[model samples]
Target: MKRRLVRKLLFGAAFICLLSTQAFAQDGYRMWLSYDLIENPDKLSEYREMINYVSIPLSSPTLEAAGEELTPGLSGLLGEDIATTNQMQNGTIVVGTPGTSDLIAGLSLDDELNQLGPEGYFIEHRVVDGNHLMIIASNEEIGVLYGVFAFLRQLQTLQDLEGLSLKSSPKVEFRVVNHWDNLDRLVERGYAGLSLWDWGSLPHYEDPRYVDYARINASVGINATAINNVNADPKILTDQFLTKVAALADVFRPYGIQTFLSVSFNSPVDIGGLETADPLNPDVADWWESKVDEIYEKIPDFGGFLVKADSEGQPGPHGYGRTHAEGANMLADALAPHDGIVFWRAFVYDPAQTDRFREAYDEFVPLDGQFADNVILQVKNGPIDFQPREPFSPLFGAMEETNTMIELQVTQEYFGFDLHLAYMGPLFTEALTSDTYAKGEGSTVARVVDGSLFGYEHTGMAGVINPGSDRNWTGHPFVQSSWYSFGRLAWDHTLTAEEIAEEWIQMTYSTDEEFIEPVKEMMMMSRDAGVNYRMPIGLTHLYAQGHHYGPAPWTADLPRPDWTAVYYHKADENGVGFDRTATGSNAVDQYQEPVASRFRDLNRISDDYLLWFHHVSWDYEMNTGRPLWNELVHKYYSGVEQVREMQNLWNRTEGLIGSQRFEEVKSLLEIQERDAIHWRNACILYFQSVNNLPIPNGYEAPDHTLDYYKALEHTKYVPDPWYN
Candidate 1:
C-alpha cells in the first residue's frame, strides 16, 4: 500500500512540472499577440471546443504564414492542440481564398471580399451543420493571412468571439516605415541597440531576425519598408546587393510587406558605366528603366525607390538643370507599369537661401501639378527637421494635384534619445489637427494626407522606425509608445493621443488602474515638458554639433551660416526670435491668405508659435502682461519642476510592477531630470547675455559658466547609425 502511494505522488509531481514549464515559456517578443492561457479559462472554454480543428486550402506562401502563426497562437491561448485537416470537418475554423474553401464559397463572400481590396479581410462566426464554424475569407491569399492575425489579436485582447461580424481595410493606400540603416548595420539616430539587419551575412546567410521584423510590422498595419538610408549608396543598387535584397523581400512577402530601397540619382555614372545621369538624356533614361526592370525581376513586388536629392550633397535633377518634377517623374514612369510608386522626399533646403524654412515650399510648390500619378512627395511633419515644436509645414496643403505623405521621426533624435520618456503622439496630433485654412477652417493635415481634402489617388504615412536588435526592441521601454502611437494613428487619425497611450500602457505594462493612471499622465505631459525646457517659445536647432545630446545655445562655429544656433534664435539687443513675418523672411506668405493673415497678427497668433513667426523684443508684453523674457524664464523653471514631479510619481510605483523594468525606467528618468536642468540653465544664461537683462527673481542661476557650456564638446559621440 505504501509503494502504491509513492508512485501516485511521483506522477503528480511530474505533471505539475510540465504545466509550470509551459506557463513560463512565453516572452513578450510576440508583442500584443502574446496569447497566453486566458486568466478566465472558463470564459474561453466555448472557443476551445469550437476551434478544435482548422482547415486551410490552396497552400500559398501567405496561407502558410497564416497557418504557422494561428496554430501556435491557438495552442498557447486555449491550452489545446488544434488539429489541421485537408477537408472541412465538424467544428473546423476554415481560412483561405473563396475558391479554396467551400465554406467561404457557400457564404457567397467572393463579391464582398473583392470589394475589400488586397489587404482587406472578413471574419464571420456562424453555425454549419449544427456545429459552430469560424471562417476567415478574402479575395487574395495575403488578406486571409491578415484576417488570421486580426482574429488572434481579438482573442488576445479578450474580446467576444461568438456572433462575430467584422470587415476591415486600411484607410491609407500605403503604410510604411523608413529605416535609416547603413551597410555597416548601424541605424541613424537609433538609440535602441545595433541595427537589426545583418549586412555582413546577407545573401549567403539570412538572419531569422529579418523574418521576425516582418512579423512585427505586419502585426501593425505597416505594409512597406525602405531598407536603407536616404543618403544613398550606389553599391546597394548593384547586382551583388540585389541578391541580398531579394532574400529579404522573400522573407517579408508572406507577411504582405514589400521592400523598397533608397537609390542614388547619379547611379548611372557612379555605379553603372554610363557617362552622365541627366534625366532628359535618352541614354540615362534607358539605363534607369533597365535597372528598375532588373530589380523587379529579382523581387517582383518590390516597392519603388525613395530619393533624397539635391540636399546634403546628394545628386538630383538640379545637377542636370532639370526640375525635381522631371527627376521624380522619370523614376515614377519606370515603376508605374509594375504597380509601384516613388516616394520623393521634400526636406530640401539651400544654405544660400536667406530663409532656410522657406526653401522647400518655394522649390516644390511651383511644381505641384507636374509629378506623375504614381509619385508622392513625402514631407516632414514640420517645415524644419523634427523640432520640439513648430508650425505645420506649409507644403501640406500647398499641393492640390499631387499625392503627399507625412513623414514622422519615431526615434527621439532631438528629445533626449531613449533616456527621456517623450511620447510623440501629442506632437503628431498637433501637426495633424492644425487647421491649414486651405479649403476652410476644418481642413487639417490629417485630411490632406487621407486624400479627403484634396481627393488625390494615393495617400499614406511613414514613420522613421526606432526598432533595433535590442533585447527589448526599442531601447527605452516607454519609447515603444511612439511606435505604437504611430501605427494606431495611421489606422485612424481621429483617435486621441491619450487613448493610444492608455491602450499601449495596458497592453505592454500592467492593466491595473493604479499603474496605468500615473504612467499615462507622465506620457501625456512628457512632450510639453521637454519642449518647455529645451526649445520653449518655438526656438529650435540649438543642439550641440554632432551628438545632439544636451544644450548648445552658444554654438556658432559650424561651417554653414544656418548650421549654428545663433542663426535660428537670433537673440540680440534688438530682439530674440526668427522674423518670418512680412517684414523679414516673408515665409508666412507661403501659406494661404487667411492663415498668413492670422499668423501675421501678433494678438491673433497662438503663444506656442509666437516667436516662430515674429521677432519680439525682450521687454515686449506678452498676452499674460509679463515681459517676453520673464515668460521665457517662467516656462524653463516650470519645466524643471515638472521633471521632479515625474520622478516622484515614478518612485511611488516601485513595488507595483516588475522590479527589473521598474529600476530601468527609474534610472532613465533620473538622467532626463539632470539634462532638463542643464537645458534650462544654459539657454536662460545665453539669452540673458544677449538681451542684457536681469534674470527673473525666482528662477535659479546657471550651475556652470557660459564658457563651461561652450567648452564642452562631443568628439567621442556616436555617429548617426545611417552614417556608420
Candidate 2:
C-alpha cells in the first residue's frame, strides 16, 4: 500500500520535471548538482517513503544552509513539497549534531561520532518511538551539510536505500581550489574566460554566481579556495582589497569553504612601505604580524596565505640571502595566532640545473624538518610543469618530517585548454596511485598527502581549478568532470575514476543506461587520447613557448634553456628523449629503491616512461618489436585515431541529452579532431627531421611543410596579459 502511494507521487514529480525541461535549455550551468526528478519507479518509491519531511532546526548558519538545500532539493526530486518540520515524525529526515538535538544526544552515538572527527558524518536508519526515520547525524554542523549532499547524490544516482548505513569523511584534511586569478580580472593559464572575481564591482555588489560557486564546491566536499594568481600583486593585501575579500568570505562561510589568498612575498616592502622584505629582520616580521591582525578583524575564518616565493621572478627571502624555510616559517608564525596555515609552493626551477626534474627535490629535501608545523609545501603532481604525461614528483613522500600537499592542475593548460575534450580524472588518479616506496612498497602518493604515511600534522590536496566568468563556468563542458573528480577523490581516494564519471554523467545529463555508458566511456578515454597525440610516452613541455597552445618541438631559442622544448626532449640525429639516468643527469637518484632502479633500467621500466628516463637510439627495439622511430610514429598516429573514435561516440549520443549542450560538445569534438591532426603532423615532422626517417606506410603524410607548420600563427592565445 505504501509503495503504491510513492509510485503515484513519483509519476507526478516526473511530469513536473518534464514540463520544466521544455521551458529551460541545458547550458551546463547547473553542473553535477542538477536535481532532476527520479526516473526509476522502485527507487523513487523508496526515496519518497523514506524522506517524507525534513527536520532541521536552523540553530547555526551551516545547519540553515543544509535545510535550505534539502527542502528544495527533495521537493524537486520527489515531486512534492517536502514539509519543513521542527518536530520529528514517522518518516522524518533528521539532520543535526549531537549538541543541537536531544534525541541524537540521548542515542549514545559517542563511539561512531568520535571516530568521524569534526568533519565526518553518518546517515543511519533509526527507530524512535516505534517510528522508522532517516537520521543524518554528525558531531558538527558542517558535517550535516556534507551528509545532506551525500544523501541527495544517492537519490540522484538511484542507489538502493534498503538498510542503508553510510559513513563518510575526507581522506585529505584540506581539499582546496587554487585560482590563478589576478586583480586586473585576467586569469593566468585560464581558458574558460575572464576572471570570476569582478574586482571592479566587488565589496558592494555580490554576484549570485558566488553562491552557486560555493554550492558546486560544497556538493563535492571541497573545503577551501585560494582566490588569486601565484604571480600576485602586493596591492591585494591593502585595506581596500581586504573589504572585498571579506565580502566573498561572508558568502562562502555557510557552505563550509574557507577563503585563502595567493600573496606576494614582498608585501612587506611593497604594501607595508618597508625598505626590505627580509624574513629574519625584526621590522619585517612585525609588519607581517600587524597586517595579519588587520585581516583577521575583517575575515575571522580566513584560511591563510599561498605563497609562490623564489620562483618565476616572484620575490622571496632569496633576495635577502635566506632559506625557503625561513621565508615560509615567518609567514606561518604570523598566521598561527588565527589557527591558519601556509601553502608554500615547491615549483621552483633553475637554468643552472642540468635537469629541471631534480630542482624541486634537490632544493627542498635538505630542509625537510626545518619548516613550522602549520607550513605545508605545495608540490605539483609532476616535477616538470603540468605535462600531459610525466612521472610523479619525487617530492611526494621524500619529506617525511614536514607537512606536504599535492597540487594538481585541473585547467587544461597543457592539454589544449578549453578547445579540446580532455577529462583529467585519469591524470589525477595516475599521480595519486604512484608508488613512492617511501616507507615500503604500499607507500602511495595518496597516502603521503593524506598524512597516513608519515603522520604529519597537516595534509592537503590543492587543484588549480580555472573556473571563470564563462556562462558554463568552465569553457568546455567536459572540464567540469575533472573538477568534479578532483573533489570526489579528495573526499575518498578509494573511489575509481570510472565510478565518478558514471555518477557525474547521471547527475549532469541523463540516467539512461545507453547515454551513461557511452558518455562515461568517452570521458574515460579523453585523458589518454590527449596524451597520445600531444606528448605520448613520457614526452613533456613541447608546446609553443609562451601560449603553449600547439606543438613547437623545434623551438630552441628562448631566454633560458629550461624554457625551450629542446631542453626536455633532446631529439638529435642519433636518438630522441632526455636521459635522466646515472649516465646522464642522474635525476632518477631522487626516487627511492625499486622505483629508482626500475627507471634506470631499459628492460625493466614500463614503456609509458621509456623515453622520459632514457635517451634511446632511433634503431633501439621497443617492446612491440618495432624500432624506436617506428613506435613514435605509431603512438602519434594512434592518438589521432582515438580522438576520432571519441567524436563518433559523442555523435551517437545525439538525442539522449539536451540539444543545446549536445550540439556544443559535438562542434567542440570537431575542433579537437583538427587540433589532434595538427599535433600529430607537427610533432612527427619535427622528430623526423632529426632521425631522417620516412613516414611509415600506413600513416598519412602532412598536408603542409614543416616550415609552414612552424610559421603558423596562433592569435588570441595566452590568457594572461603579461604573457602577451
Compute each candidate's TM-score over C-alphas: 0.91, 0.96
Highest-scoring model, TM-score: 2
**Where is model 2 more than 4 Å wrong at Cα?**
1-25, 127-130, 713-722
What is the C-alpha local distance difference test score of candidate 2? 0.87
Error of 2 at 504 (Å): 0.8
Expressed as tens digits, the lDDT of each residue in 70-189 for candidate 2 is 887888788878987766688888888889977677677888798788889988888788777888889999998999999889888998765778989889999999999989888888
- The local lDDT score (0 to 100) that residue 553 gets in candidate 1 is 78
lDDT of all predictions: 0.81, 0.87
Clashing pairs in 1: 187-721, 188-721, 188-722
Best by lDDT: 2
Q: Per-candidate RMSD vs. true structure?
A: 6.6, 5.1
